[model samples]
Target: MPDRILVPVDGSPLSKRALEVACDEYGTAEITALHVIDPTEPGYSIFGVEYDPSTAPRHGSEAWYERATELADELFEELDALADEHGVSIRTETVVGRPDREIISYATDEDVDQIIVGSHGRGEESRLLLGSVTEAVAFRAPVRVSLIR
Candidate 1:
């Protein structure tokens, strides 16, 4: 069994499913939740037409950074609540970088034994069978990758 499982949560239902699976299958192991911020994300603002309303700050602005931090905190809070419900403890981390690279890098740097991630995120790639980020992580991660739909 993996001593630690790293899960990347992006507030998407699929990612949430991944988290749920990690908690269910590895309740005794350490679990870490990671959230990454992509500065170049198109239409990142809450008012943008490309994405759902996030009440997010203007993309690339100072307020955007602040909002990102705030959102990260809230994300962790939600994860903590989920963990509590499952009788598990989850450590959360937030970073500013490409999601795939950050997820793989964290697993490598922290020596995590496995990664449980969603097949897709909150992006347009859902139409694809596998999200680009998830595909990259599965191919590049030094540790084992378990993808949940």
Candidate 2:
């Protein structure tokens, strides 16, 4: 009987599936959709590289931050629409940081009872070299983690 279920979404098909799983399994709980704004992401990167967002070109500029917020907003809107279609009320959240760290910290700070995540299978090589967010959260989160592939 999880009280609060946290789902970290990245607009991937896997993420959508994870949301659906949460809705189906935790129908009576508080389901939350969290979108992490990774400034180091290539698409939102101020510079050509995502190695370090703090040193990115104009990284702290108003335009750079605005772009990040814009991307987060778009994801939130899409999540909201999906939740509506599922006939479930979801609480939305946005945070700026590394996706895995942000998600883990939020779950702890907010006392989330469980976390439902998706596995995008970012390719076998990448998964071996660098684990995906779902893997990281599932391993590190203090709360229970349910992964939907």
Q: What TM-score against the true fold does each predicted structure earn?
A: 0.85, 0.81
For residue 123, model 1's alpha carbon misses the true position, in angstroms, by: 14
RMSD of each: 4.0, 4.5
RMSD of 2: 4.5
The digit string of per-residue lDDT tens for model 2 on 1-149 reads 99899998877777888898888878689999888877675456121223345654465567777776776677778777877787888998888899899999999999999999887566765635324777789889998888776
How high is the lDDT of residue 21 in model 2?
88
TM-score of 1: 0.85
Q: Which candidate has the highest lDDT of all?
A: 1
